[model samples]
Target: MNRTSNPGDNQTGTSQRPFRVTEDELERALRETLAGRVAAPQPLAADPAAVALRRARRSGRRRALSGLALAGVATVLVTAGMAQLGEPGGNHGTPTVVLGDPRGFSPAPLPTATAPAPGPVRAELDLILGSRLETSGGEQQELTNVGPVERAQRLPDAGGWLMTSATPAGRTLWWLPPNGSPPQVLLAGADAVAVAANGRQVAWRDGPDLHAAGLVGGQLIAANQTPAPAGAEPVGFAGDAVLIRQPGRGGFATWSRSAGARPGPTAPNVLAVYGELPDGRVVGLVAAGKPGRPCVALLDPARDLSPVRTGCGPELAVDGLGAISWDQRWLLLNGAGKAALLIDLRTLGTTVTAHPAGPPVVAGVAWTQTGVAMHVDATGGLVRVRPDRVLDGERPTASTIDGVAPADRPVVVADAGA
Candidate 1:
């Protein structure tokens, strides 16, 4: 990090100035940190797949470090990145957000959207810890008896919410009914949980096995548990299957009750797997060039995870905190401490718009029936970004939801269809 002094500093007797960290500098620091932290343990040498496992651990560490660094500088980076994107001949109609110098590689243009643009829908924000709901009618109501929760998501069809809380034993997953009943324990010692887009199916990793069940009457039904790879974390749901990132693996894998678990598709240079489309296509960030410039690509699962479309720009360099809209038409990713990158998936990889929302996206992003909503660090209130407005060449802006106060932690849209 470096600071630039103001010209009138001497007169004011103030030496402090704004700090800036270049993309190259950030990348250098990240590589150095990973080099020291990702060294393979000597005890694993006897394993036949020791080398492969080491590589997997290294990749995971890099992703984790990248996210931490991005969160620290999110406000600064987003401010600078947005200024650049707002410049003439920048992203007004163009499809990318290029920061600093441009790399020579250009991707072929993909097909544009053929269907009518989606209309905006009424959405509400749920202040998780605050235990309040900001309704569509601009009114607030108490969300009774929901205690301190670390992570939570609304169930499909307003079935209620799935939440996780820390306990003396470990972490506990609880199901809170929509009718104001007490929370029920869904799973104990659960690590990472993934809820299906339709909300009928849920999967989670508990210790050495993966467990999944159907959501019926606010209970987990048809519960099934299966063995999973060590250090496997459920990321998202790909239709009926659970998408997982296994340590020491090249890409991602899918686990299902009937099919068990197996590698689906992957690439050599992928750094992080964000989410999957309803049809099982995967979206992830890929590193290229000497310093590892990142690009986002839409991968076809049927074609060995080959990229169907790819887009590279400075804005694509992110810390890996991201979410894909339920409709599979948008991607909201954390920028490297500078801005948040929102990609229009309809373009297949070409269009990327930058929003200065900072990073470590509160309780994750929520997708309304026709738009997107989430809280950003820059704006203490809930921010909404409509896909149709961005497509119409409007710069995305943040407006506070009526009757909702700014929240410091984990505020998400409740019945917004996520």
Candidate 2:
């Protein structure tokens, strides 16, 4: 029997192509065979070359599939990484991971938000006169014309003005509202009046009786009376208590709704009480003897009137004329000389001596709502002295307030109510 040689046989017994099939047709046939739509017919006898060829084709197909699968996995990983990096157009930059020494690594603190500081208080200038009061803005109101006004002060809350003037009948305490309302007589024979720094309570002395009342809507209500020592005058309010200056005694006494009357600060050297600080401390003058050199002292009423701090100097020879800033951080003292001293209570030693221009006379001194220390010179010029800059030991310069005449005295309207 004669056997025909197979065309697929090679010298090395490897596979050889007997007929050509395009790549598309082979791929289709492979798909159809896997899907079971086409049957792969088996030969009665298997050819070695044909079997090897099929095995090689399968190996190549598997390799191609593996490469494609790896590429797909790489693409998926790259897309996920970009998504975690956030949007493209942002402030974010490339991420960097630092592996620092365990002992030196410290995470940065997160940022925080803060509220803005409030603006300065709004104040007005009152041109006080014997029979009338005029504001710098041209508002006018007539006064009782009780002989030249003796004492006048803007309420701590700027609710109104408190004035004490002499009448033929006797000394009278008057209240003038800021709205140009008619003057209201608080006490006909009122000896001394004191209003709390908060502008809520008022205390006045009428003869031997001490009167206390609540101030609401420019009216006095819930009146309370207690018998006090004759000639005792109210100086200020200590919480809900009235601080009274004893006539014979040099120290002060306290009277409240709960406590009728009680002895106050036993300290014998306290000569005068200027005002109350925001912290309830009283700023006063302390001296050893009459006409003796006086010192600025902070007396704590809560501590049995103990002296917290004291500052003394020739410039602090206040002639019983001074004004404390609304914040109680500054004290302006008009000395015996032409200059006035501005003292920073925070540092009792820091002082600034302000001299007026045009004349050596400093008629009066006050603190404006804007924190400026103002004084009227003999020329009636409104001299403004800032405490902040002068507190640094620098020479203070004065600026004249426009539209104020040399004969007119300008007083700042205290707007502490807000």
Candidate 3:
């Protein structure tokens, strides 16, 4: 619970300096610090597993606190480890928000100005039928009363969402809140590209320009008009910088608000970038074929030119952002036939969790308060999984969710005390 402001905020002058930090500096500092020292670390006072869980729970808070300022846009950073004091007569359990319908959702009072929640993650599914945003076993609703959309991202705060709809001319970006307010248009472009977001800011590609704005209000705060190299596309936002990658490039290059574009760390034969981990590691999928195994190496963001390849296997289908666990340890990969692979980063081990009687395809995966969950594409249900059991090579039982199909592009959103 200890909070400290940056040194720049402590200047004694009439004119106050803006609080600014960048991903490059942080990465470089981490690299140099690790390189110059090799000392024994202090032992934890609690159970190691408990410590890991605590750190996993606090990852959201750290990322929010680590937000950087860009182009005078004041970033909204929230701490995640606050006490969950409930309201009288309020349901603190999971709540769902549906899209593509005129059903109204009342705006509940936000959490007591704390960080986003860590457990019971909320999610939205962008499917072929329409866009459905909801919680596990909660009420289902459509994203909007408008036409079907291809892409949608749930805000980190879980209060709103950003959606892209395609037309005969081009694509348009729209922001919708949970309070049943009318959808507001952010912009329209020839092509609606990838969008990345942290707690406070959201950065997306509109035609050739990269636009960033507040996650809550969806106001246009910053735009990057510099044309990307030929086929490069934006993957995510690191601090205040945009992470972009070319089609065949193995690594990512960062674009900052001040320093136009600079090369970032690269991996060998990278297929996709799953955004930055809470600990600042850039997770990606690397080619690691074993005959017909169809394996891939999982690389964490590195402090050096080479990234640490933690795990590899055919089950490690790095579906980019959606298949990651909250702690960054477990990866929900596509299993051989009709199962999902759950890889443990700590042990570098892989386990296949398959249902004896259910769907054959695992579409999406996320971490919930109780355990891990995956959307079964065949049966259109959500299955709860046990990481510990799966890692133990046991036939882990899955609780199937009814009425919900596997999401095309499923995203986990932590319910921020609403």
Candidate 4:
């Protein structure tokens, strides 16, 4: 079935179609098939050190091969340009979290359901200044200023676009309401921002310090700010935690502060080596053999890292709330687009849904609340998947900017074709 292709608009639907076959090819077959070359696949020695080295080499190789394949499939996923979710069966939240292999052979049926009429109406966007995006229900948004937005972003479940871009110019934070209505804006302040589901819990930073305030229902509450480290710069925040990346005694340092507390987790370990799963679990990579050498280590702050899944798709942002992919199965590569392959470690559960308008090549990914968007290098667009219904992306037909008027300009942050 010709899967509708539109990364430009919000999300909509069509009749459900069965999933196609898309199996993950081992390195040997993939090299011969995709590249049509006779490059020798690296052999894995039985020893731990040898295996570790082989795995690292494979990870690099996967990243490289995915580049070649990204062009055709990039539109299906998003990238991690640097933001990093969900539930548990326990402290990890009440959901299933697994670290299945992306390479082993597995095939599963793709889920399907009927989407309600009117379709997906609106979406809250998580964007930075100078970035542009549109939603499926016919709404458009743009960052029109050079305001302080390093800490500003949109909450997934909210209706209005959240902002910390508030200044004294009567500048308003806009929220595109559902039901084909006009967008509304609220007056936000210097360090002020709002989360749709949680209203305004605006957080701002002063030098190295971070602060938060909010509107409970309708009452405005004074915000509490978190202090920045003595010499470190504020990288960002997640919930109440502040991230600071600084030069340490040896290498770079990563620090975080939640509430008004001082930063801890003071290790020179670069934060880039960690993966944040949807359940707030932190997965750190630790290579084998070397003392403190980094191979992939799963750390769930809520639960002990011991119970977490280890080693399969070790570097991916494995989820505990929902399925690893739109189809609710492990992807063939570490990702969905062309550049990075999405491989499911699960048993025989592979699917290949047609993505007619994906990117030319994919490298990294950024998972948004609506769906996991891809980072392709030609035309960036979103693939909106309605969990139980069907995994389908959207695009507008009438040149309508997801409902934003011609005056509202949206820039490209996650394009299938970047």
Candidate 5:
């Protein structure tokens, strides 16, 4: 009898694929081998302090190496004529969310999927503090002399940053350049009811009026006056357009900056609206299929408020306003145990990562290209974690942005190349 050989098997009976190890798998195997040859890592319970410190050191080294590898990969991709995809996920179809109907709506549950094997961590963001913007390269700049700053967002082109500062007069908006020039006062009011910006334009709502202006300096391009309604407020600036919320008639009416505060067509059951993505897609918060569960939905501003994706899960709730990554691919929502829920826009996948102690409450959290930065109010600690590892239940490494008591969540400013 003649026997056939399998493609996976060699003449010596060895497997050709050798278990098909990934880069992460190979690194983990090497670490295990070295550990077995010497000694195993100490359990966190045995010595929590020592374990945290050791992990911090190890994490820093790993991040540095990952950054270098990403740089090389990026160079090769540029040379190979392949466009670098910003966030990994899919946008395949147009999903519809009925304006007022509750029946027949069934949202998928939050995914418990583990993060795929992590690639190199791209270190390209600066953590803004009261004092300055601290780069990952350990360089710091005292860009502003403002007192008790409330919020800071980097402008496009690295032209400058827009911040809300608390002065003896009141809460005011200022444009501070990297060169440490005198801050330009943009707006002075009690506090910004709502604020949003795209590198070229800035928009803020104070009292009943919404204002928009250019970053460099110019006359107000748009001013919208919202009449007194039970619950009406500005959502955010979507590129040049600003979104405003109005209470329900049939469903709810949303406003567009380009439309001069005129209410758009009503959509049912739309709870909250975030802002617009770069591609002109509008993102909002709506009740999921399950009652009391909130989810993020991508809707077309010009069309009906239908969802493209709505699987943000039960953990996603915004305390005040929702936070999103600069790339417009991730939505950060409040979670229990001081944790925060991150939802991927392309994939509609969810992940939870928070402090282990779980008490101080996540004061602020920001997402960059490769990972996230979380600040805990209880510990006054700023930690960084790979989103993939966080989904895998790995602890975050203590970040350099420490000691500052943030008034609000800090924002990550990406360099031009990042």
Candidate 6:
């Protein structure tokens, strides 16, 4: 709830800074910080699981804060923390215009001024999806130069530190590079959001209409959604096609691409919702009459795609590559922890023992790039690994292989060579 001026807002004799945080407000500050980190903050899901976990985690602290007693004890601490954020000591990054999209999102009043950013913790690299005309990650404390930033679309579950950005014209898109080159800009923006790593294909939303088949062979292949059957709403999009939820039925249809017939072979009641994978493959969960019993299926339209394999079992991984990404190539899935699979997408083979004998990955297999930058989520400073080398930070080493950004957040820590 504190505010700092834009770091470089100095005109005449005034200087600007970041908000320092305090212990009492640590939780809120942390949440706010993370929320700002992502392109669009995830909506708080309306379910028992989400609420229950939140309640359990805060019960004790809530109980201890008797009325405004703790509030009185922490005023100065809060101020100090805000100052710490803009203290002349931390990493300072380039400026970016952060668009705040609260979940359950209703339009709110815009602030006359922008929120002050904390001193940089990482480098001044452009790692976020909406960070247009900017640099982030890499430094802290130093002042940032502000400018207009835009992100036509944002998604959190695509895995790793990833977000998609579109140009002002809404034509070209630049993706975060796994290798050292600049981000890839394409004329892509359409229904749902699409971003492919291995082959580098991307599509997202612009205004309300969808843009598709962009930047192929250096040309833009554009397509528009030509109205649904009067009642269907868009549910998901893959490549140039979109899946619309049909009215009064438990069915979904691929519109536009229409390459595949509606209600094809798969019954409306037993259809799967396929999402595009990082490697350009389709994956979906085949639902059944039994609400609790859904199965995972790796789909390949190019192939038979007739439910290749079913009942992957509950032992499957949450962060496991989407069934479609898995279907795209044959990678060994060890079925243990996040880092269990050592895959060579080129060979469609397994490398085994990708993780260097360590504790389990409490966090999901949070990948930055497809397989380039990886991390092990531990309590205090987890271990981060990248292609060609492992960096515990005790040892930072660069590599010939280009690394992906750590997450949509930023590469807080990288091997010396990354």
The residue ranges of model 2 lying beyond 4 angstroms of the native Cα positions read 1-124, 144-147, 153-160, 257-259, 263-266, 288-293, 349-365, 377-381, 389-413
Top candidate on lDDT is 2
Please give, for residues 130-227, the per-residue lDDT of candidate 2 as tens digits.
Answer: 36676646766877544445556666545788666667766777788878778888777677776665667778877777888987767888888888
- Ranking of all predicted structures according to TM-score, beginning with the best and ending with the worst: 1, 2, 5, 3, 4, 6
The TM-score obtained by model 5 is 0.55
Clash count of each predicted structure = 6, 1, 16, 88, 1, 41
TM-score of each model, paired residue for residue? 0.58, 0.57, 0.53, 0.38, 0.55, 0.34
Cα deviation of 255 in candidate 1 (Å)? Answer: 1.9
Model 6: residue 102 alpha-carbon error in angstroms: 71
Candidate 5 error regions (>4 Å): 1-124, 131-145, 167-170, 190-197, 217-231, 245-253, 259-261, 265-268, 273-275, 320-322, 326-329, 349-364, 371-378, 397-418
- Lowest-lDDT window of 10 residues in candidate 6? 139-148
Give candidate 1 misplaced runs (Cα > 4 Å).
Answer: 1-123, 133-146, 247-251, 259-268, 288-291, 302-306, 349-363, 378-380, 387-408, 414-418
Ranked by lDDT from best down, the candidates are 2, 1, 5, 3, 6, 4
The numbered model that scores best in TM-score is 1
Q: Which 10-residue window of candidate 1 scores lowest in summed lDDT? A: 93-102
Write one digit per residue (lDDT tens) for candidate 3, span 1-418: 6556666675454347576669998999898888766564556677889878899879755545443232112221111111222445544443232222223545555555566644433333322233555644454556664444655555655556666677776677777776757677777754534555434555555555655554556666655455555556666665666666656634456666553644454444565555455666665565544442333344443343134553443454334534455556665555445655555555553422322322333433435434454453444443555677655556544333433335443333332221
RMSD of 2: 19.9
User: For residues 1-418, what per-residue lDDT tens digits would candidate 6 score against the true structure?
Assistant: 6456665556423334555677879988788888886967677657789888999778655545542454544565556666676888844433222233223446544556668754332322223221332233432221121112222222223211233333344334433333334444443433345443322234344554433443343334544434334445454455544545545545455544543233222235424443555543445444433553444554544432334434434332333232222233323222344333333333321111232323333422233334343333333223333434432322322221113234332222211111
Question: 29-60 in candidate 5: lDDT tens per residue?
Answer: 99989989677655555777888999999978
lDDT of 6 at 398: 25
Q: Per-residue lDDT for 298 in model 2?
A: 82
TM-score of 2: 0.57
For candidate 2, the per-residue lDDT at 397 reads: 47
Give lDDT for model 5.
0.55
